[model samples]
Target: MREQYMRTGDGFLIVYSVTDKASFEHVDRFHQLILRVKDRESFPMILVANKVDLMHLRKITREQGKEMATKHNNHRTSGSSPSPVLWGAITPYHHMLSKCHYLIYHLTKRLCELLSTTCYFRAHKIPYIETSAKDPPLNVDKAFHDLVRVIRQQIPEKSQKKKKKTKWRGDRATGTHKLQCVIL
Candidate 1:
């Protein structure tokens, strides 16, 4: 799967059940394999620990899942500053600011919170959906849709040069030709 993803530059959504220790171990091994492959680093992955209804039989605890996420987040830091959400607070605010500025500040804070949460989830390669195949509250189709949304959100857009199209270059045929030759 990793090889196929690497070769095609396609993302993957891997869902696994963690009912037993062996299955959990398989997840760990696959996670390590993903890290080792290195080529799929940019590919999106949604690691779902499904079948939470069978928690009585679960070998992997929620805390273990969180720890795995933390490990991945730490590994991918790249010496950059910690996420704003992780930092917990921004600089001190001005007392003279108007209500509109206060509202903007709060809005910005909320936006940062959302971004950081999403970043942490993607960085850790952990996307969990608690669902049961039997007596399902959220159906399989919805779960898959959610996975796609998460994966799409996780994929960071690459910086590309913007080409100016004047009347000469606006010809459909010429634009198509240029697009065909432009390599990513």
Candidate 2:
């Protein structure tokens, strides 16, 4: 699955439920597989801890999730210069509202760490939003829009830099000719 995604060159948003220890472990393994892919730079990753509505059943605490994200971000950032803030964790609205402020706090702390360590996201200050697939007030659309906005901002900057570097040497001659023509 990781290879397939890498071949397509599409950024990935990975969603996993944290209801039990088994699922949490599964997420860890998946994360490792993603990291093993050679062209991981082409693949931006967002880790979503879904079903936060079932906080009572949460086998993995917010701190654990943040720790995993931090480790993953650190590894990815260390390998690449100006590492993009491609690492983040999101929670559902139910958890956000049910007196689980710890979730937000931990996520914020992790974001701060990533910003401090990674140049790409630090400059942009990537957004963190809460969402719920189940509730209207939570507004999954807004969360996704925020993600899209960040991606749009980064991808274009990368492409623009590449475009500038690839400009034809003849462009200067053309510009000179146009100026002479105008003067004549």
Candidate 3:
């Protein structure tokens, strides 16, 4: 049943909890399953580490997640496979840009956010986003949005013409029956 969805899904989000070491270890099995089901060398996948709010309980490091993503990331896209999304630190305020240059201040701040996210992905690879679903979530929406972009990047431009939408109706409550692709 799970294989059925994997066969139909265009993209995947492989989510693992940062606090669960065992869950992180199980990622490879799921990844291999997706490949075997798709029978493809590469696919659009985003490796997500959730539960970031509980930093004290985190068992997986960000570096570890990134290394895993690089191993699983596919670079079929034309450009740097995985560029970036909005994230990272804010730039230091310039002494010259006082209260007088309020417009520059806002633009610079926005630019800084965009630039920070790209630094990690410049090498071109799968996105590894750490998220927390608790109140005041972080990167949850970004993860899904990035997955869409990744899928779009993989498809050939010629076939990108909009196709008729087909609605899928599922009878079971199982995750597989409703959507395509595994989220574990």
Candidate 4:
């Protein structure tokens, strides 16, 4: 059933939880499935790493998520294929006043986030952003806006395949393309 939707889809938003390794893993699998179903090596896709607010419980590194995207995209960043959708690879941190929430104090976490962005910009070349509901640098809305823009741009170009022209029983090729009104 999902395959059916994929077949007709103009673009895809593949999301995973930043805190869950399993969700990140599933993003990889889904990427493969989409390629198989659509039979295209590349398409307009956005990979979102959500739930960054749960920093303490993060099981997947930012690098891992970006690496997975680079792998699935076959390392080709541009040309002919539709532009990649803007992605949100978020990193959330806690404030002293927000003691009611859990927090992760690993020094490398922020470094990893910065490294992932740098890698993507320097090598992978995909539009990447970071979004967190409970943190700064939030971009959840921007991710969706980018998705809509990409889909609109790609869908029209992809559907440019020449459509077959059909004629009705009383139709004439030389006549106006618009249907003629008939009165009894």
Candidate 5:
């Protein structure tokens, strides 16, 4: 049943209570399951540390939660070159100062984001949001909104006039694959 839900989900909101350490431990499992089910190294997911209102009983520190959320920033980079952000841009003599300034500003911002442990587009890293889960629900709405934005960012535009008919399969008696539906 969990696998079925994972298969159909376009995005995921992985929530763990700050008062429970076991929930925090399960974060890695859920993340891995999402990757495995999607058969992709990266997916649109938001790690939410909920129950932030109970600060006194928080078993997980803010730093710990953030570190867990960012654990996959460098998950896999096999044979990949440096990111464009890290590369210096070439410009004319007059534009050198402006480019340098821009570079400095960008780098500083990135550093701050990483240090603060909350980021969107921080090099394919997952965004982490803290939620209170109380009456007001701190950041709960933002978490969902951010996940939607992430999903939107990942979906490719359909430029072709002709649409492809997507096919899905269901489990068979022998645990083999069989065509379940072909919806146009």
Candidate 6:
């Protein structure tokens, strides 16, 4: 049923509590399931370690989270190229909703920047932000904005690639230009 639900998903955000080792371990299984279900070599995904405010209770260190992300980033399906995996830490200061919003903004920016350097295009970036379950209003708003931005960025690139493919087709018919368009 989960695989069926993910069939139409454009991207995925996998979250785990920083204080829960079991949750963190389950991430790998979820990732594998997604890959097996989608049958895609690479896909946009973000792994977030939440509840960073409970630093003393954190069972998953920041380094461990990063390592996990890196492992997934290097993974490929059916001999395809590696995919990009972005990870982040977020503390949901439920007592102060405003602060949580502010932190989410900063986290979004930083994570997006880090994603820019990866093999994925600017449009393929997956955003990761941390916010408490209690801070519902702001977290939802910010998450929506981030999702919109990612979709917007990808739209132009897809159009441009389409145009390029059209040009390549024209060249092929003319016999004056030799080229190929490989859709991946």
TM-score of each: 0.45, 0.46, 0.54, 0.48, 0.54, 0.47
Residues 1-184 of candidate 5 have per-residue lDDT tens digits of 5577567777775555555554544445566777899898888776555556776886657765445455745221001111111112122223432443343223321211112233332534766666653455456456556667777777764234355666656476667676566489
Expressed as tens digits, the lDDT of each residue in 1-184 for candidate 1 is 4354334422333344445343333334444455556444544454444455665875446665565556565211011111110101111112211221232223222221112323445455565443344453333334345545654565545323344453333457655432334558
Q: Worst ten-residue run, lDDT, model 6?
A: 76-85
Candidate achieving higher TM-score, 2 or 3 = 3
The 10 consecutive residues of candidate 1 with the worst lDDT sum are 79-88
Tens-digit per-residue lDDT, 1-184, candidate 3: 5576577677765555555554444445555677788787667776555566776876656666555455646321111111111111111122211321232123221211111222333343556777654666566566656677777777875366665465665866674544444469
What's the CA RMSD of model 1 in angstroms? Answer: 18.5
lDDT of 3 at 171: 69
Better of 4 and 5 by TM-score: 5
Q: How many collisions between residues are there in candidate 1?
A: 0
User: Residue by residue across 16-134, what tens digits does model 2's lDDT show?
Assistant: 34443333333333444555663343334444444455568655456554444454442111011111112222233333234233332332212222112123323222232223344
Question: Which of 1 and 5 is the better model by lDDT?
Answer: 5
Q: Give the TM-score of candidate 2.
A: 0.46
Candidate 4 Cα lDDT to native: 0.45
Taken over the whole model, the C-alpha lDDT of each candidate is 0.38, 0.38, 0.49, 0.45, 0.50, 0.42
Clashes of 5: 0
Shift of residue 27 alpha carbon in model 2, Å: 3.2
**2 versus 6: better lDDT goes to:** 6
Per-residue lDDT of model 4, residues 127-171, tens digit only: 433345453435555655665665676667767765445544453
Q: List runs of model 3 lying over 4 Å from the truth.
A: 66-125, 157-184
Q: After superposition, how far is residue 29 of candidate 1 from its true place, in Å?
A: 4.1
